[model samples]
Target chain A: MTTLTHPKYGAIWFTLVVLLGISLLGPLTGSTAFVLLLAFGIAVVKAGMVAAWFMHLAVERRLIWFLMITALALMAVLFFGVAPDVMRDQGQNWGALAAGKN
Target chain B: MIDLLLKNASRSGVEIDKLFDLITFLVGFWFLLAEAVLFGLVFRFHRSRSPRALYVSGEEKHQKRWIAVPHVLVLLCDVVIIAGTMLVWSHVKQQLPPADAVVRIGSQQWAWVFTLPGPDGVFDTPDDIARVNELHVRSGAVYHFELTAQDVIHCFSVPAFRLKQDAVPGRLIKGWFAALEPGRYDIQCAEMCGIGHGLMAASLYVEEKEQHARWLQENAAPPRELVAFRFPNP
Candidate 1:
């Protein structure tokens, strides 16, 4: 029996594993920002790999690519559009501002 | 039209409304256009006159343009909206501007507990002022809040301030907003936590600078005893 094979699967899998390891070790840095960045970055890379290789999106039809791009674009609109109101800074009070000096 | 949507009390609230208006206009235009096209096609290709309809599969290169052109326009619209929104997002959410006041909000199933640093400007101390369901701040002053939930997840939302953050159990979320006007605003639990989720509401009083200071002083907790009274350490 013949098993299906892909030329880049092994390399992609290895990279994903390495990324997972890095993300797991990210918490050891004891920096919240660093850990968040590393985890998110790795997740994005891993997602891209899965989509490209496992999902066969790398060689899919143009229509499929178009649909995927459209979906992603819509998701971006949803995320960014709602973010402004959610993220606005509430200005500082006089007491708190003065306290920061110490 | 802006006032019809919601009351804008914060400096950022105005910007949020503007963004909302822009999005509404963009989407409204597309909605009308799509509806018009749908109605037009229905009448233009009516069954009475033409027995054979033009069945274009859109698989051919020439036929694909019918699908591609509209999709390209949609993509262009998406790009414009995303770019515009992201600029506002980075300004509001990504960059945490220096805040003059900090409040820690702990949410439970049916209540919000706000902890304000005392005169010494340190939290988790004996002098820390803790209030339930009421938060007071100075108008025009920037205030940052750290939010967390004691049990179920809750959202700390002040519609007037145009700010909302989820208070997840064991996770601290930070949010900030500045009230432009001195008024009492309602704080709603945007995320449903439990049976009494709808009842979980609070009031935010944005007062004058002088009034805020007086309120703080009046509400400040008395200093705690330095030594804990126990059974002589067992």
Candidate 2:
């Protein structure tokens, strides 16, 4: 990977500037849901840029790519495994005790 | 001394202390043994002044069965540990508390606000008492806790209870714990939130059920005057 002064750095800076501008104004003028989605999208782009350019993960060999892909697949499975439990209703005391039901 | 960060013999916060101790001892011993073996081999088989070095393990079958067996054992232990911990974690997260007591905990930058539900089923009402930092709970009863954060992310951790959950901004996190003993416990902020993160702490006050009720009744009385009392101008 080249140094920060490379031409690619300018593109990165421009993208960051656009993201910053949108981040600053989007939440103030838009719904929270929209702002969250926009933030998440920008974060994905930023992470991809950092990994490919700065981390040099893009230039790795095929074996390293295979290992990375396997790790990502495992992470996806783990995330899906936990998503259901995390979304489940934990405990209800107030709702029950309020009705004199419990 | 080896278990410097370990809890005492008594059970309080989380009941997984024994399991944790066993796992810690096993893992710690294995690492020390492995490192010792590696260093011993390196030093014993060093090519000092001798020009020729032994090339005994060129053939796969010539490798020591002891080393190969230990390697397989380590791999098996790794898989077993991961599977076992995953099962325990899932079990802990899935189990629901009895539908009796519930407390609302609001975690801000430097303190925790604990709100107990009143007769009206709402928290922090005129009839309910708001406790800062310290939470009073009854022993042997399962208390369902609802967690909320005022600022950034912070984790509610009770080392004795072996229970922890993260409080996120704009989102509510929930976790439950039932303690066997009625004693004071430390509430730690496990997440590295910000500068004052370390200072953000709370105390858990567990008392007998009747005493807890009396304390609640004494502290939670409604304010005497709802309307302003003023003298009429003559």
Candidate 3:
């Protein structure tokens, strides 16, 4: 047996709306770093709700789960491969990124 | 190579052109070879010549060589390009020659202001020559430019010189170039800053020694009218 969601579509949609409002209003508190972190946390919750209830990922079979995981793993490999060049503080012939050039 | 058609007037542009030519030759060779092989195969295997179809599973060692050989060759080409690029980068950027003259380049919305050392060859003095959208330099002299942006990020690009540098706001970026010949060149902003980015262009005048000295001496006198530089209260 395999599972990827809930049948309560209306309840999930309402919860998503509430999370959106909270995330938008969270910036007014003036603690930008803390509020942004909280907003991201809310976004993860909302995303999970959408996937499990709206998109029905929770009810999908094991094959669908394997496909999704493979896609995510490939994306991670791409990120790690490119992150070094993008985030390099000091690299050979990086005259533009050297100290005091910023 | 396009270098034969497009003129390169700077010291480092010569080295860059060599690298460009090498890459062009290698890539062009591979491109032509691949295309010829593709069309040749198509013509050789035309349906009229043979009614039967042959299956290619690409599992055999012979079939595998098709992918492996080209893959290794392309990687070798990549290595050559990377090595040449690093050498050019090192020669053009990492090593800085002592400046014979220094120019201060200030970029803002829709305009560029250049401050060159006048007859005295000293900045911030009465002899300093400041002009808007016009830069004058003497040929055969190494000039280091201090580039900065007043409003937003802008790039100083000279196509003939193959020189391009970004002018970042609140930062002083130093770069150098030497004009080998005396001529006028187009100076343009390569970075998009505002609505007037396209119009943000200037002229670089590289003059002969005697001509440059004459121009320097002529512009030394104080002007009857002064142009004021002001900033609004933020």
Among these predictions, the greatest lDDT belongs to 3
Tens-digit lDDT track of model 2 for B22-126: 567668878899899998878876777445787776357547776788789888877866776665665455566463588877777777777776545565467
Each candidate's TM vs. the true structure? Answer: 0.65, 0.61, 0.69
Q: Which candidate has the highest DockQ of all?
A: 3
> Which lDDT tens digits does candidate 1 get at residues B51-160?
68887777999988888998998898888889879977866776667899998788887988877887667876667777779888889988887777777889999887
TM-score of chain B of 3: 0.91
User: Any runs in candidate 2 off by more than 4 Å, and if so which?
Assistant: A1-102, B1-15, B46-52, B57-59, B64-68, B119-125, B222-234
- Name the better of 1 and 3 by DockQ: 3
Clashing pairs in 3: A4-A57, A4-A58, A5-A58, A5-A59
* Residue A99 C-alpha lDDT in model 3: 34
Task: Report the lDDT of model 3 for residue B181.
Answer: 97
On TM-score, the stronger of 2 and 3 is: 3
Where is the poorest 10-residue window by lDDT in model 2 chain B? B225-234
- Compared with the true structure, what per-residue lDDT tens digits does model 3 show for residues B1-234? 546676888888888889998999999999999999999988888898867889999999999999999999999999999999999987777776888998888888988888777899887677777788888899988888877777799999988898888887655667889998999999999999999999998999999999999988998753434235321111
Model 1 spans > 4 angstroms off: A1-102, B222-234
Judged by DockQ cut-offs, is candidate 1 incorrect, acceptable, medium or high? incorrect
Worst 10 residues of 2 chain A by lDDT: A91-100
Docking class of 3: incorrect
Q: What C-alpha lDDT do the candidate models reach, one value each?
A: 0.78, 0.68, 0.81
* Top candidate when judged by TM-score against the true structure: 3
